[model samples]
Every structure is written in C-alpha cells, then in structure tokens.
Target: MGRAPCCDKANVKKGPWSPEEDAKLKSYIDQYGTGGNWIALPQKIGLKRCGKSCRLRWLNYLRPNIKHGGFSEEEDNIICSLYISIGSRWSIIAAQLPGRTDNDIKNYWNTRLKKKLLGRRKQQQQLHPATTVEHDHHHHQDHQQSPTSTSNGLSNSALERLQLHMKLQTLNQNPLLHNMLWPKLHPFQEKLLLQAMNDENSNNNIMQLPLLPQPIMMESPLSNIGNMMNNNNINVSSYGGAFQLGGGDFMMGNLDNGTTSSLVWWSNEFETNDVNYDRSGSFSSSSNDSSWDCALRSSDDAGLF
Candidate 1:
C-alpha cells in the first residue's frame, strides 16, 4: 500500500518561508501550543504549509529559546562524541545540547565540525603518521602507478598501511584530498576491508568485495586487490590507485592506529587550476557525468533529502 501525503501537497507553501508565515506559526504556537500534533497544527494556525515543513520551521527556527549560530567547543565535543558513539543521530545529539535543533546540529557538523575533525586527524598524522602514497587522479599516466606498486616503496609497515592506502585510493578519486573523505568504515567494515586485503595478499591478485553485511555482492574499483569499500550502496571505480566516484580525490592514513573515524563532509576547497565542478558536481566541460556525485551526495546527507 502507498503512504498517505502529509497534507494536500498542491495547497501548501514550500521552500524558504516568508516572514508572515513565520509570525503566524510562532504566534499560534505561543498562544495555544502544538497540542502534540504538528501535522494538524498548520491548518489550525491557518497557514498553507505542509505539517512536516511547519514542524521543521518551528522546531529548527521558530521555537522558544532556540539557539542559532556558532557552536561552542562543548557543543562540538558533544556532537562529535555522540556522532562517534551513535553515528549521526542528530535528534539525539541535539537533545544533549540545549536549544539546538537536529537540523542546526547536522548543518554545523556537515560544514564546520567536520573540517575541525579532519584538521585534527591530519595533525595527528604529522606527528606519528602513516607513509602516504600519492597518486594523481587527473592524468591516466599517473594512475598507471597503481596503489599496490605505490606501497611497494614503503619499507616499514607495508601490509597494514598498504591495505588502508589502497582502500582509500580505491574509495574515490579526486586527489589525495578525496580519500581523506571516504566513508568511515564501520568496525565490521574496517575488519572486512583489511580481511579482504589479507586474503588477497595470502593468495589471489584480484577478488570480489563482500557487501556491507547484506545480501548483495558489491562491485568496487578496488578491482586491483578485488575491491575496497565500507558501504552497500557505495559503488566506486579504481583507476590504478586513484578511485574516482565524484569529488575525484581520496587519502587514507593510520587506520592501524584504530583511531576510528567516519566520512563527514568534504573539508577542502576544489582546485580551480584544472579541476571544476558545480555545487551539484556536474562537470562543466565536455564528458560530463555525475552518477557517482549524486550517489555520494545522497549518502552524505543520509535521510535529509
């Protein structure tokens, strides 16, 4: 059976809201309260908004004592810690923080706290880091270097670093910048990625990657050592070592340290000299395709879409 619509879709206002609508929602809620039914509240207040939109506006923006702008270190810690513990349960994380909504917390994490974490991770690597293998994603000649061959240069700790570096390189390809942002492997996934590596190193040259603990088999660009990725839907392609999904870059460091981290948002700016993509990630020049771009963006946003 099909699901019911939240309200009469044709009759409601959408997109960025108007001041009048805001005032009406705020005033009505202030005077009488939501009565635990946001779906009905819009109609009660005589505003032409879908109940979900009305609820989001009120909960995220209009509600009393709601804090807007600038997260504190405490809030950031709360967000990051909760994220690491619970994994993007924004509503739950927001509850631990006073006056912050799930949307607000989510936006901050996506745009700011994410960068902060990457910056810190990068710093830690500088002090006691993995030997990074560089690969150029733009030129096919550069990709010919191959991740396994790149790691062949590493004298110490080749096995662990080699597996993660290959996995990161295989995750997506923009540059080393893109690998740093690949989906953070779940505990099970991290094990699985390395497991695939161990199995390959001990025996075969190429192997198929297992799905993210589900029923389907996943195809990954990690076709070199088989495939490497941590998600079910996260389809990736490998060109030698540089994996290019959409943003076109990737880097992995120090996974053996077990300082577990997951994919947040892309933290770096796109290079303009030769690299270019719009907010939607469609290539502006000839040979344009954004299927991977669309896939990663949707996964990054989770259910927000």
Candidate 2:
C-alpha cells in the first residue's frame, strides 16, 4: 500500500515565510510562548505557517544563546576525555559543555583533535631512554670525577679499561671467527641477544630454542598435538618445525590448548585434504557486504543508527 501525504495539500501555505508572517508568529510567541508544542504553535501565534516550519526556523537560525567559533584548548581536552570514556555519545557530551551543540563537537573532534593527539603519542614513544640516560650520567660525572677516579658507579675510566680488555680478549680468541660472526649477524639477532641477557639478569626464563613435536603412533590417536604445544611454553620456531613435520600444506590455526580432540581432527583434516584455502579473503568480503546491508537497513528504519 502507498503512504498518505504529510499534510492536506489543498489549503496548505507553501514556500518562504513572509516578514509579516514571521512578525506575527514572533509577537504571539513573545506574548504566550511556544510551550514546546510545534503542532499547536502556529495556531496560537496567528500565523499561516506549519508548526514544523516554525520549529525548523527557530532551531536552525533563530535560536538565542548559541556559541559559534573555534574550540578552546580546555574544550578540546574535555571533548577528548569524554570521547574516550563515552565513545560517540555526542548528546551527553554536548550537555556537559554549555552553549555547544553535539554536531559542532563531533566535527571538531573527528577533523582536528584526534589526529593531533595520535601524532603526539607516537612521537613521545619514539624517544630512546638509553641515549638520554647516558648523556645525563656523563654530564653529572664530569663535574665530580677526579684525575684518577670517577663518581659514576661504573666509572668512565673503568668502562674504557674494560672495553680495551674485552677487545684484547676478542683478538686472542678466534680473531677471524669473531670478526666474521659479529659482522654477519643481523641487528634483529643482536637485539634478541640483548633482550635475552636482560631477562637473564632479571632472573626470568628466556626461551632460546624451539620445541618440536614428536610423532606418536597410538591405536586411537585422539589427542591433539597443537593443544599440547600450546599448553607447554613452545616457541614459534618449534611451531614451524611441527608444521613442517605435519606436512608443509596445513594452514596455521589457533585452537584452545585444552581442546585436544578438536585440534587433532583439524590437523588430520588438513593433512588429508592438502588443499590451498584462501578463506580469509572470501570471509572479509562477505562480512563487508553484510555490514553495508545492515547499515542501509538501519538508515531506512531511522534517520540515525
């Protein structure tokens, strides 16, 4: 069935409201007020305009006490804090800020403040603590150090002597091997070694080797090897080795360590099939289409989500 028209079309006043009509509405409203009833407002105000038109005029342009300008730093901070806590509840945020509309605050936050805060956070996290500490320590020790000694715990002179000793030791032990290995190792390997040493110094376990699974031939073979690998603190290297042994065609999957039966089934299925599956790409496309359809349905139901 077709829907009815909004209002009776025969005698309805259309187009721009004249100054005379506006003045009459304004005068009547001044005397008795709009009383928040747009439907009855035009009748009370003695105007030939619809209630909806009057409401739109007052809200969009004629409303008093509205603030229209760039936001201050304090307002920016308040908006940021509110956004983090409440997400996109702009109406609640607008209520907290006097003279500010929800629409204005939303636009400002999305277009300006969000990007600036993210950039500042990234910059702060990139500063190197080791370089900063060393520079400060050197400045402090320069004033307090004597000719023969230094104030720092591991003094500059002592560090230099230890470095020279280490160099001499390196020359004495397999000099060619040391040079070749040191130069050949990637920076990532050096960083890993440093991290491992730090963990050891702090009395924490540093995993150096990969754990690979052994093939066990049982009558039922109901147990899941992936679950066992996860329950134990197995490393990625071990995972790679296990992957190779299980037949290099199985796609990497994450299963609960406790669900041994499921894991075993999955591994067995993959081994038997040995088929290349690009399921992720298809799944993503389907999800996107579903989301778009949901959004369209929501829009049809209401003006907002």
Candidate 3:
C-alpha cells in the first residue's frame, strides 16, 4: 500500500526562501521557540510550508547565535576528530560544536575538507612514487640485515608463519594461478623450498627463491574474488559486523562455520574484461572476457579441485 503524504505538497512553498518568508519565519521564531513539534509550528505561524521544511530553515538558518562565516581551525579539528571516532554522523558532530549546523558541516566536509585531504594524498603519491616500493625493499633488507633477526616486533615470526600458511592454502586451492605467478617453475619453487627445509638443505637452490620478485608473494590470495563470485552467482558484502554471503547455488559444506572473516576479497573492479600489460609498462583491455589472459577461473572450476 502507498503511504499518505506528510503534508499537502501542492500548497507548500517549494523553492528558494523569499525575503518575506524568511523575515516572517525569523520574526515568528523570535517571538516563540520551535514548541518541540515542527509539524505544528508552520500551521500555528500561518506558513504555507511543510513542517519539516520550516524546522530545517529555522534550525539551520534562523537559529539564534548562529555562526554563518567560515569555520575556525579549532572547529576544523573538532569536526575531524569527532568524524574519525564516530564517522559521518554530522548531526551528532554538529552538536559538539556550538553555532555550527549539521548541514553546514556536511557541506564543508563534502566540498572542501574531503577534496583537501584527497589533494594532499595525490601530492604525496606524486612526490614519492616509489614510497611503497622502498618500504617493501626495506622490509626484505630487515630479514637479510641480520641472521639473529633485529626486528623488535615479537609477533613477526608468528605473523610470517600465518602469511605462509595463507599462501600455501591459496596455492593448494588455485594451483593454476600460482603456476603462472612463478614463471621460472611450474609450482616447483614452493614445493622445493618445503622439501629442502624438511631435508635440512635450505641452503641449496631453494635459497635463491627469495631473490626473486617478492611482490607476487604478497598478492592477495583472493585477488580476483569479486569476478569469481560474480561468475558463480555469489554476492559478497559486509553488513553491520560481519561478511554476508548467501545463495542456494552451491553446497553447504563450502559455507564453513558461519564465519567469512578469512575470505578477505576487497576489490570492486571485477568487470569481465581482460587487462594486458605491454613491454612499455602500459596496460590495455580487451572487449571480451574470453580474450583476456587472466589467471582467474570461474568459482565452479576452482571448486572442482
């Protein structure tokens, strides 16, 4: 059933507030407060306006002691801090800063502050294009820097083990993708490393494996998961506190014990197109998914093994 209108839409003033209307609203409010019921305020004041509109105009524009100028540095800091802690609940944030309306704060954030932050980020990325690259290099140098391992983080060893465990699990599940990643070996590198370690021959050819490009090792396990899911009719998204996924498309055994916390696939670019990188370090896309050379497969194929 259709819901009833809140007020007579045809009878209300709908555009920019004229000077006379603003003066009338201001004069009416100066004589009496909102009376805690905005719906009744417009009618009592003889305004041909919706009650909600009257309330918004009064609160945002006609409120006493309202600050209409640019926000100060202190106000900016307050808004940023509150936003970080409580997110974009502008009304609550506005309550913390007196004389600042929620709508004003929102407009400032969307039009100015957000762009300012993004501009800073773009500047940094342009200034230090190799920042992440250098970071990854230093990470490697740390391990090779000393045999005793000078890292102060006590959990580093456990974290490394967890990472390897995750990589191994993903490799096992998607051998074809892993095979392409290791161009020099057909899934023999990791297996060889494990074999050498088990046989106490870790100083052999396996030692050379670490010299190879380590970026691919850090590539996400579920790298193309969005495409895989889309191809499989699986819709994955987060709601409230947990990951949610449900469809009668697959076996119940694949759904594990109600926890999708480990399935960390966070990319939204899963268009069914192929991405190609030429020798000049530029990428081009093909028109059709069939022509693409992606290592990913339909989740159906991945599940077969």
Candidate 4:
C-alpha cells in the first residue's frame, strides 16, 4: 500500500457540531479567518474535526446569520429568470440570492417554484385554447405586447391558443391520419385526447394527463365492429376495401390482395391489427392495441373515453 492517508481515517466525528465544538470553531475562525489553508484550520481551532470538516461545518451549517426558511417573492423572481436563462446551475442562482445557500434555493425551487410554474402553465393552457397556426401566432403577438410578460406567467388566452394550435399541428403533421376522425367526438372525449397528446408532446405545451382512473372493457364485441366501420377510409382497389367506425375505429377488411390492417375502438378502447394474408386466402391477425380503458369504469367516466 502507499503511505498512510494524510489525515486520521478512523473515529472522525460527523454531522452537526455540538455547542462546545461550535463555539471552539467559531472562536478560532473569528480570530484567524481560515488563514488560507483548510488543512491546518482544525488544529488551530483545537477541535476533533479535520480542517476540511471544519471548513464544511462552518460554510454549510454554522456560518453566522445564514438565511433560512422560505424565499421571498423577489428571490423567486430572480430564481425563475436565472433558471430560464441558465438552466439548472443552482450555485449561480444562489449567488444572486443574498444570505441564501445553494441547497436552500434548490429546495425552495423544487418544492415551491416548480409547482407554481406547472400550475400557471396548466391554467394558462386552459384559458387560451388555440387550435391553428394563425391562432398561435396571434397569441404570441398578444403575449409580446404585455410588459409584465416574463416566462413565469403569460396571458392565459395566448397559452390556450398556442396549445390548440399545437394539437392541430401535430395531427396535421401525421399524414397517416386526419382531424375528421374526431369530428363528432363528445366534448369530454375531445378534452381527454387533447390532455393525453399534451402529456405526450415534447414542447410541454399542455398539462400531463392523469393516469387512467379505472378500467373499461367493451360492453359488447359488436361495438368494436361498428366503430371500425365508421372512421377509416377504405381503398377498394388496393386491399379489396378499408373500413372505419364512428368512434375513431378503422380496419382494412381484406388482406389476400394486400389489405389486412384494421383499427378498432369499443367501450372507449382503441386497438390496431396487422393481418398477414396466406396464399390460401386466410388472414392471420396480430394486434397492437392501447386505449383509455379506465374511462369505462363507470357511466360518469364515459365522457373521457
């Protein structure tokens, strides 16, 4: 082994100092003021701790007049601005907040500011409600006009409009589908889908959707068949035919000629199937499905499905 460690490696005390240790450390530091070498401070202080431990104890725990407890409104503003500007550098943020330690600021931000920002975002989204590119641009303009518009809070209308525009934009961007699929969805269903999409969207444009609260299985298998007939656009020439249902279900009815995919929704559920057509004309179905099954737990929950 190399030479023994520089400092004693056994029975070194840890954690908050006792009153006597605190007084000894404070008194020694008051007279000598660190002397530019932490490795020598503990010896000078006549304490059991090593110099490194003494420095940590002083800076982190026993520093005179350390500000503790909740941060004020001014501090909250500074922290938010710094976070938006610099990301998660807690030490940098702490420097701007006098008397506050980095750990303190970090805790307050995690516990208070984060929740406030999330709530403000959700409320803003609910209020503005945009559904198109033009609407989002208009809302952006409105927000820019307000002098007090820091990222902390924006005009609720603007937020809502941006959210709506984004939702529509996402659906539009997917050439595989169309908005007509949801043309006649119940208001609650529309809201649920929007919430889910918002949660999934990387832009943080909408509040996350809560986990499904209950389970929903189709009341009858026929419900899926009916739903499948209403929503899909069938390509009669390529795959023999395509089918879709009213509640956002779709299917390709025949696969022998190359059409064997279908999407189905029933009892507030959704699923998709890829069927392989054999030379003998038999179609084998392999399905990949997902749905808000919880929405069917009770009649009151039906709106979400």
Candidate 5:
C-alpha cells in the first residue's frame, strides 16, 4: 500500500494566501497554538488550506518576527558561506539566521544573489581574461625526430613540451617563478648546466670547459615563457592548484612565498619514472630501480649537483 496524500488537492485553496487567510491562521495559532496537529489546525481555523501549507505559512511567513526582505550584509555572508559549505540545504542554512526562513533565503539566492555573483564574475573575467589554449595536431606539415624536434616536427604540442621543460628548469632553479626577482639562465646555459650535472662520461670534458657566466638581472623566466606562448598563440595556466607549464604535462608546486610544496612530471607519449622535486631542489622517485639523482641550485647559491 502507498502513503495517503496529506490533503485533497482539489479541495485545498492553492496559490497566494490572502490577507484574511493569513490573519485567520496567525490569530488562531497565536491564541490556541497549533494544538500539535496541523492537519486538524485548518479545521479549527476554518481555512481551506492544506496542512503542509498551513505549517509553511505559519513558520515561513506568519511566525513572529519573520523577516520578509532587506537581507543585511551579515546575513548575506552567512548565506554565501553556508551555501558553499552545505550547498542548497536552505533549512539548515536558515537556522543560522534568526529572522530568515529557508524559502526566503532560497528565493533570494535564486533570484538576486546568484545573478549578482555571476555579474561580479563576468566583470572580473572582463578585467583579467582567463587564458585557454587549444592545440590542434592536424596542422603539422612534417615529421622530424631530433633533440629539438619530435616525430611531429616542432608541432604545437612539441613546442608546449619544450616550454614546459623550460618552465620546470626555471622552477628547479628558483622555485619562486617570477617572484624571486632573479635573472633567468638562458636555454643554452640551462642545457650546459644539465649536461655538466648529469653527464658522468663527460665529467672530465665538462671540467676542462670554461665555467658559464653567473646569471645577472634579466627578464623573469615566467614572463619570457608567457611571451613565447603568446607569440605562438598558446598560454600557460595553473592546473589543480599547481603551476602547470604549457598543456600541464609538467606541473610544479604552488607558487607560495618562493617555496614549492611538490613537483610532478608527466609525459603523454612516453613512460618515464615519476619524479618529485621539493623546494630544496632535490629529486626523488617512487620506483625502486630508478637511479635518477640531481640537485638544481640558483646561480647565487652553490653549484648544481
């Protein structure tokens, strides 16, 4: 068997409640209370309304000091905060605001507050437009595999990867991105440094070569990367709270106070050992067989290891 309807839909007066009906409901509830039965309360008040309707009308409207509108700033903050935390649980949110009802808060949010927030977002977007880059591979004309060129032959994706590697090197050097106020080592200089650090076979040869000049006041690597991407019709964006380079294949730690919490490297076409970089420029891997060990330091600091 199914549960019975609360009231006869045909018999109950629906839509907006009248002033006379409101007065009757309020006066009866005030003098004698609901008598603990809203279903029978309508019968006592002689009103052609459903029990649920009577309860809502009393609790949301006719109740003492039921605030109608003109929601204050403090109320708005509470509503927004609760909405963020508990979502659209209006009754629970309303419990925090003494004079407000769930219906009022919900209606206000849907009608006015939602649009207001969206308008502010639109304004912010207009002021500082978000960067969204899309790479299409069908446009590549040739295939050439080299240190600088992949099978795609300098495609947008390859360029993105190069830029990502460059960004990683930049972060590995400073970990502060542009905030360090330090000059960036050139791409050639970075390559030389990497070779000098990683190439064990050429350690004697590298030692004989003249040392690279210390980096001086130059453009920030971040700014340089941005310009490069913009010129190539691509842009950099943060991914999952981490500073991502290019299409997010390489992600660095959060740029918080010149300190990196973590770094992760990913490749779309190759399987490589996952590496983690910390603020100290030390690298570690989860794989046991991996022997990758490198430490990148700033020019002003000790030499790279």
Candidate 6:
C-alpha cells in the first residue's frame, strides 16, 4: 500500500513563500526553534504551508546568514575541487561552505560554473593553438622514431649517432670503441664488420653495422658518464681495497696500485683532438672513438695492448 501524505494537499499552500510567511517561520524558529518536529511546526505557526515547504523556507531563505548567489573565489575553488572529488554530493559540498545551500551550489554549478570553465578552455585553445599542434607533432615524431622503425633496426637517435660515427675516420682505426658500443655483439655480426674493414674495393670508410639489440644503442656514452655520476653526487675512490663512494661499497673497477685514485679519470674532461694516423700503419685518431687517447697508460702496460 502507498504511504499517506504528510499534509492535506487541498488545504496546504505551495511555491514562493510570502514575506509574512517568511517572517512568521523565522520569528517562531528564532524564539522557540522547530520544537523538534517540522511536520507540526507549520500547523503551530498557522502558515497554511506544507511541513517540507516551511522547512525549506526556514533553512534556505528565512534563516539568518543563508547566502544566495555571488559565490567568492575561495568558495568557487572549494566547490570545483569538492565536485571533482565527490561528484554532485551537494549536501557534503554545502557542509564545507558555511552559509551556502546545496540547491544554490547545484544550480550555480549547472548554469554558470560549467560554462565559465568551458569558455576559459576555449579561450586558451584559441590563444595557444601552436602549443597543441607542437605537442601532437612531438607525439607523432616519438611514435615514428620507436625501436620498431627500420634504420638498420635502430631507433632514430641511435641511427643518427651511428651515422655521425661512420663519417669520422677515427672510427675505422679503433676497435675498442666498436667493442664498447656493441659490448655483446654476436660472432656473426663481428665477422661482417671485420670483413667490411678488410674490403679494399669499398670506396667509402662508412660500414653498415648489423641490427644490434636495443641496449647496444642505448648505453651511455663514456664522455657523459662522468657528468652523470657527478650529477648524482657519486665520488668514486679506492677505500679499504674496494672502489667505493660515500662509505658504500660500489665495486666499480680494480684499483690502480692500491693507492692511486680513479677519480682523475672519472672527473677529467674528455676533450676531442684532431685525427691522425699511427706510425705502425694502423690509422689512429685522438677522438672519442679512441679509448686509448683518454687512458693514462705507463711503459709497463705497453705489452697489454
């Protein structure tokens, strides 16, 4: 069975409470309060209004300090933030703002706040169209330059670096750089590069290296390793027979003579020099491709080469 109505529909007044009605509701509530019963309060006041209508009038309008419209910047921010988090729980949102009603916030959000945000967004798009376009262009470039793309099976950056290395005559002279660049190259790939080096008929010094694993292309260049370590505040030095830093046992490499520090090599600048051929018929160049150029070798280490 349906529930009975709280008040007689025929006798009750509805919509837009008059000034007299507002005064009566406010005056009675201020003096005696709703007497813990809203359904009986309208009858005591003799307002001819429903209990719900009287309650709404008292709480939303007739109540002192009940704010309506003209929300402040702080209130707007609070409303927007709460809306994003809680989503249309206007009663909870209303609780956060001292004098604002749930209905007022809901109406303002629907009619004004939403449109205001949308208009501001549109203005931004119009003002900075190039920014959006540039972002999309960068995204497209990243997608195109992915590792899957073909350039001897290398990513765009790696391929560019490789091409740059190929142009330098120094690369043909040093085999150590090749080993460093491709630390784990397969035997077949090594054979192909060796064959290319031996080919006398090859017009240009540039040799096509086989498709290597992505890690080979991504290894940090030796020149930048010092800078990277310095940025992270890593101070490498031999302490207690172990190459360590900041009291932590890092175990980077073997110590030189147990006393000589590797900090000189780690901290030194790797400056490039002009390319030159060695006297032993092997073309050697004092550049980044030649690791021997940077190494501080003594007469005792001559036979190790």
TM-score of each: 0.44, 0.31, 0.41, 0.38, 0.41, 0.40
Error of 2 at 7 (Å): 4.6
Please report, in order, the local distance difference test score of every candidate based on alpha carbons: 0.47, 0.38, 0.43, 0.42, 0.48, 0.46
Best model per TM-score:
1
In terms of lDDT, model 5 sits at 0.48
**Cα misplacement distance, residue 253 of candidate 4 (Å):** 60
Per-candidate clashes come to: 19, 0, 0, 24, 0, 0
Candidates ranked by lDDT: 5, 1, 6, 3, 4, 2
Question: Model 5: which residue pairs collide?
Answer: none
For candidate 3, write residues 1-305 as lDDT tens digits. Answer: 88987889999988778878888888987888777888888898788999989988988898888887688765665554334323455886677677999999987865565434323424534754421111112335434422221121212222222223324345443322332221122232244333432433123332222111111111233333344445645554443332333431111112222433222211111112233423222112233321221123222222221
Worst 10-residue lDDT window, candidate 5: 130-139
RMSD of each: 18.7, 26.3, 20.1, 22.1, 20.1, 25.1
What is the RMSD of candidate 6? Answer: 25.1
Distance from true location, Cα of 30 in model 5, Å: 0.3
lDDT of 1: 0.47
Which candidate gets the maximum lDDT versus the true structure?
Answer: 5
**What TM value does model 6 have?**
0.40
Ranking by TM-score: 1, 5, 3, 6, 4, 2
Cα lDDT tens digits for candidate 6, 41-149: 9999898999988888877887889988888866665565444322455776777677988888988876666444323324534763321111111345435423321
lDDT head-to-head 3 vs 6, winner: 6
Model 5, span 115-208: residue lDDT tens: 4433343453364343101122222431221133222223223333333333334444432223323334444335543443234222243322
